[model samples]
Target: MASIQLQGKIFIIGEIEAMTGLHIGGSAGELDIGGVDKPVIRNPLTREPYIPGSSLRGKMRSLLDRHLNKPLRRDRPQVRVHECNRLADYKECSVCQVFGIAPSRNMEDTMPTRLIVRDALLTAETRERFNEIDTDMLYTEVKTEVVIDRITSAATPRQNERVPAEATFGPLEMVHSLYTLDTGSEGSVDSEIALFDTVLMGMELIEDDYLGGSGSRGSGKIAFRKLKVIFKSRKHYENPQSVPIATLAEGDGVSALRKADYQSQISAAMQA
Candidate 1:
């Protein structure tokens, strides 16, 4: 076994507020639905709408893959993980370096993933006051949608559940570990900045791409706000410094949140 040194760790924490009705569909088992076909996922214990980290991470990876024009494997059902062995000489593959590759080819090669995205839960403040604002304890708003038959000009109505626009969910956390290679460079990608860039790129892409489902019909629009990046070192993990990053808030809405200086803030965190 080879020795791998721990370099540093960066933590990004923020809130995700729904701009429009957001619907990340959950299984509609045998539950009777009067007219609803799809339903948003809820925490089994609280029955509150929560965003799964897997959904966010997967969407970001796919978006980055498309943006970079990286060749994707057609054999797999989900997005393909890039191989560090496949790229050209001396070139760092951003996606693979950040997200990492699982062991394959008889478990011969493996790249440990660096990024960790935790499930986002509704903030306590919002959860408590949701009923005051929306008059629903479930924290979800029901949207009635109509599908018009183009040829017959007939309208068929269906009900969809969504997290209402302007609703906030939070403490969304993303932790990225930095490693120093044996050759003294920061992992195969050579710089932590590259990894941060990849993360921000995916985040920005999601703002345009939309999350969950029914994006074309204007569902799942969201924005990240109050982003704070913190750095921790093994020697002084107890006393970590918060990186002075700019807030994503530009105005009172989602559009303002999208124009955040994510990269610049990350750069400051890296230096700190």
Candidate 2:
């Protein structure tokens, strides 16, 4: 069971089907050639649309890299795009390679990785307190805290209005169900967390279903259930300094814990 202790709330933004002015089926002028469904489409059962983490992460990283005036690296591919391929052989394509695993045999039935946004926060008093410390040390600490907060809050899109809205879904609308953590760092975390809290406070949790078809004709639907957020410490894990965002709920901890205990067993079985 691989467990991560998160210290903040997990906010999910429901997927909205963007009207791309594109239609499916093969037809020049009602020709008899066979046609297929749309690509980058959502699966009906899951209601939630599939946006590869690679897509989201890549876009964000590019924007961030551009803002920072830094040259981007070729090695670190975006997470969502990497996971887009369903074929086992292609699983090593990029993002899925992180877990060192491929999509299940029934790729359509398998759950696509839920996109998550993590928000970290700190008290106002804490920020001022740190300012009194030595310049170099204080600056370094602040930078670290900023990076963590940026990573967690990276998922929310700034051009939200341009995209379709998910209001009909009730409290879960625009809400995402994911595991979150608020590692105590500094005031940097507070600002980021506050931003998410404000954005998700009144969103509805919708249960609409959408069909997600892959390039290989593999397809599945998604239905969102509950939406929740959790907070915990990084000190609990073996790699105390690292942060993790999970897709499972707190109640699902038992299964996750068991999996952590026998990771080798699970990995072996998965490979077999």
Candidate 3:
């Protein structure tokens, strides 16, 4: 920690807009007749549905792990994830470098986690719009789905509470910190692009894939919009400021990121 230098931070700012009904289930109380079978998670204070940072990050991590085809730990059946606990494996693995491994191993031997995803709350304007419309819940809607029994041809119906389509969550912010090891070797998504690309790839994967639960059933399809990337260095922190580097529109994220070597650009900016 003493020898390594933190060059700067790259902030990825954007909005997560639901293209279809989104459902991330909350607590299930005692089964009550006429109550929602599955309810979207909500902020206890506001009673408004929100996208938790953990959910977003976990989905991204899982998607990225799949993208890289990283190996799962068969040794621990309980914890099924790509862990970079080994010092040798960690040095070459950017997936775990960006999304941190569990601290089951020695902290001193491993690199610091690079990414941080903040909670994305329902936008105020979207909330206002939903208030005017006649949603079933405070800021959500309940849709009843029926399941059919092929054998008997009997139907069972259940209600699912979800954030209605066209709802927007923002201002979603993801921070990617830059740390240089005392030794020259560092894990990279590519030699030129480095760790920044992995974050962009995760975002793209989520957009093409889905955010929350029940993706195949068309519950959580989302798009990233109004993206802005900013750079802040140690000196910038001392001055309490950041520099805006780029702003992107919907469907222009990962491709735009891959077009340039953002790692080199940001590192140069950090040093400057």
Candidate 4:
């Protein structure tokens, strides 16, 4: 009998505070008249903040690999058409075929190519806060949906390369979920931390769509965006410790905190 193959999917759940900026296109745009410009309006019912899908997908992929203890294959050529082998091949068979290069000449190293984050929600706590505010009432949390458009990248050619790489995945779809965060609550930070730690400590990338739903209130969905993967697990040595920087120097203070302890802090606060 032929050898049977088994595949496993990993599922991860966590909260991400908007670190940069985020924006969604309105239903319409306006032209400047008399030295003044009016912005387009969007549907009031579906007022969901836009979180880039690339952001979610990239983070998830990193967490997934950490959980699985498997390093992604990164040495493969960027041009897929020039490469005959698929990402699955490396996952299933550990084989990669290079186009215009002989099989023997093909590099043996493999890196993760497809990192997807589908059916994601913008922290449930964020949604609940939005709901608590009267339609007529506005709050800063409404602006809590960070504007991620201008979050600049680090000064690294590889980091620059991946930004475009992530864009190739196409527009992403955003979904909303109900997450709770209480001020003066114990273990809040810990709760988030625990959740993130759990995700990073797991293996596999599973499918989930808990946030995608349609109700009488209409569809509550998030926006989706794509990003390129120039490099994964890039590391920088600082103070005698090696830090994993997704895109070179992008792993500074806050980014490093997110990569290391932010989730745990949230979890702890939630628990408190």
Candidate 5:
């Protein structure tokens, strides 16, 4: 058995705050109401709008895939992680390396997925604010939109329920792992840092893009706030006294995301 050098894991935690009214559609079908064709997804227990981890993670993977320009194999338009090894080969693709690859039929050789995203719930602060508002009004706001026919000038109306702008949801958390193996290779540290950088870049890409649904129609603009990544190792877990890798800077807003220095700080922390 080949020995594996256990590199530390990074936990990126923060708030995803809505910059514009955000609508992540729920399972609710066509309903009889003021043209409310779609409604925001909610927690069954709290009945409050929440961002599912799958929604955020899927968007990140898609954006990264687009940025990487890695399209599906001509023969295989869709491939599972297991199938990834045989068809639509992306064995070396960084996006796949981080996000995941479908398990191969054998499944013995597949690497574990490095990224973990948890469902983003309303922040405690936001929950408190909801208490001040009428419980009946706590449900998201619904916006009615019209689809106009360009030729006949006919109008069709549809409504979408959305989490209002300025509302915050989180401490959304993601874990990215780094592993060094026995295979002949270049510096693992640099490789790990590079992978982490890609994760950051993915978040940056999404900001220019959007979150949730109907982004093109001007919904789902969001920003990560107080975004910080903490590094932990097996030793730290065992001893509980060992200091973790230096803490990352808080992601203030979209502006902070745009700064080149933000990327540099990550590299510096890793090297330190």
Candidate 6:
């Protein structure tokens, strides 16, 4: 196995706007505020609702896991999702490469997890607005969802707290790194560009798919808006003289980004 080489880091900056309500479950017993059964996770200090990085990353990985339809491993029964345990499988699996997997006995089989998702918090403007306005809770709202009990077949009322629709969580940043790994090369595709595209695909999938809990019954519809991608080469960090490269389309939103085919632009920029 060849030693891994640092290629660069890509930053995906954007705003996650809730097209519909979003409910990422929080600790129920933590607080008895509002009497709502389900509450969205919040910052312990501020008590203002925010999206967890785990929830955001997990949802994207899960969507890709299903989209790729990779065969789930039998050995690790505890891990419910499909994981590429071997060197050969890890090289072939995009979900494992991008989202990553736990290292096995063969150290070369796995590399560092390329993606890092930051906890999304409400934008300054939005937070200000929320602070001023009257809400069921601080910066969040309580919604009642009536569900049916399977055995009893009775309508059960559930009060779920949510970040209301049209609310924006901004300065959303996702960092994806580019590393030349020695898992053994399979193709000529640039590692940086491929992983970048995989991350974009995850974001796209998440846009179509609901996030958080109660997605099927309507809760977590979200949109990535004002998206931009920036690249910082290995030299940029070591040397102050190096300038970060900005690779972005003409317009805002994910649709525009897809239309621009960011992979091609990023590839070009990386080489230049």
Tell me the whole-model lDDT of each prediction, alpha carbons only. 0.69, 0.28, 0.77, 0.28, 0.72, 0.79
What tens-digit string does per-residue lDDT give for candidate 2 at 180-256?
Answer: 23333444333333333222211111111122222122212223233333332233233434544433232211222
| C-alpha-based local distance difference test score of model 4 | 0.28
User: What are the models' TM-scores?
Assistant: 0.78, 0.26, 0.87, 0.27, 0.81, 0.87
Q: Candidate 1's C-alpha lDDT?
A: 0.69
Off by over 4 Å in 4: 1-4, 24-45, 50-55, 58-116, 131-272
lDDT of 6: 0.79
Cα RMSD of all models vs. native, in order, equals: 4.7, 22.2, 3.4, 19.3, 4.2, 3.1
TM-score of 4: 0.27
**Residue 235 of candidate 2: its Cα lDDT?**
31
Once fitted onto the true fold, the runs of candidate 5 whose alpha carbons sit more than 4 angstroms away are 1-5, 29-35, 73-91, 105-108, 133-137, 150-152, 182-186, 254-272
Question: Comparing candidate 1 with candidate 3, which one achieves the higher lDDT?
Answer: 3
Off by over 4 Å in 2: 1-5, 10-12, 22-50, 76-188, 191-272
lDDT of 6 by residue, 30-127 (tens): 86668789888888998877888889999888888889887865556576677776788887888888888766545473768889999998888788
* Weakest ten-residue segment in model 6 by summed lDDT: 182-191
The 10-residue segment of model 4 with minimum total lDDT is: 158-167
Give Cα distance to truth, residue 264, candidate 5, Å. Answer: 11
What TM-score does prediction 5 earn?
Answer: 0.81
Q: Superposing every Cα of model 6 onto the true structure, what RMSD results?
A: 3.1
lDDT of 3 by residue, 1-272 (tens): 54665666778887889999999888777323337888788887887899998899999998998899999875476778877767788878888888887776775656678899999999998999998998888778888888999999899998898899999999998998877656334342224237777888888899899988778888899988777777776567666545434332233455565566565565566445
CA displacement after TM-score superposition, residue 154 of candidate 5 (Å): 3.3
Query: Candidate 3: lDDT over CA atoms?
Result: 0.77
Cα-based lDDT at residue 43, candidate 5: 83
Give lDDT tens digits, candidate 5, residues 168-270. 9997898888776664253664575567666777888788899988899999888888877677654565565554565654567635634445334544544
Error of 3 at 125 (Å): 1.1
Q: Is candidate 3 or candidate 6 better by TM-score?
A: 6
